[model samples]
Target: MDELMRRRVYGADHDDPDPGPRPGHVYVELVGGPLDGLLLDITGWPQDRLAVGAALGTELGKFGPGGRAVYGPTAAGPGRWAWEADSP
Candidate 1:
């Protein structure tokens, strides 16, 4: 299976961060929901924006068309983010 898919299906240990991200880019792995295991770049975002997370629009979510998948930073897990909810 794909690495990200494996991690999502097989649990957290599969999140192997061996080589890590390219230099100068800040990435956070989104866990759960339709966007699970997707890497989001938050490189130049302000602290407030980072704190509030994002309402990302996607067609794959439970809400179907016009839906947004909300994800927020993982307080206990830096470099990772958690799904909050889905809204249409």
Candidate 2:
């Protein structure tokens, strides 16, 4: 599994620093939903609009960083988000 994906294997979201920066990973959560587990990071995307991707069986993505494309599953969006410490 990719380093990013590996970090998620723990089944628990880890703590992140800054919450906004290159060294930081993006986390995505629905504006209002019930499902909550691993908060998906939505930073990999460009900084401009709200990108929409998958999370907890829901389709949601936010656009940021101009227009980069960041996406993931909602089923894993809720808790604290952090990189695997060795993510490429």
Candidate 3:
């Protein structure tokens, strides 16, 4: 195995198309309320798995494998955002 295969950011439940990290499109997270929109520049990511994994590590605050989700106040943005997996 290589360094790229070592990173696993996707949940066993998420099965969307492989939108590589720094994907051209911004990921949106709308909770509690809505806004005109919050955009974060993700142009620095790659169009492959390596980029996606790195991005996940940056957001999750670590570079391991699996962990539970932790949620903070509601925040909408263009970049990547994470919340408790059970958050509503």
TM-score-wise, the better of 2 and 3 is 2
Compared with the true structure, what per-residue lDDT tens digits does model 3 show for residues 10-79? 3322464542223243343312212112222334355553232222212332323443333323334333
Q: What lDDT would each prediction earn against the true structure?
A: 0.73, 0.34, 0.31
Number of colliding residue pairs in each model: 0, 34, 1
Candidate 2 TM-score over all chains jointly: 0.25
Show where candidate 1 strays beyond 4 Å: 1-22
Please give the distance, in angstroms, between residue 2's alpha carbon in candidate 3 and its true position after superposition.
43
Candidate 1 Cα deviation (angstroms), residue 58:
0.7
Ranking by lDDT: 1, 2, 3
Q: Which window of ten consecutive residues has the lowest lDDT sum in model 2?
A: 79-88
Question: Order the candidates by TM-score, highest first — what do you get?
Answer: 1, 2, 3
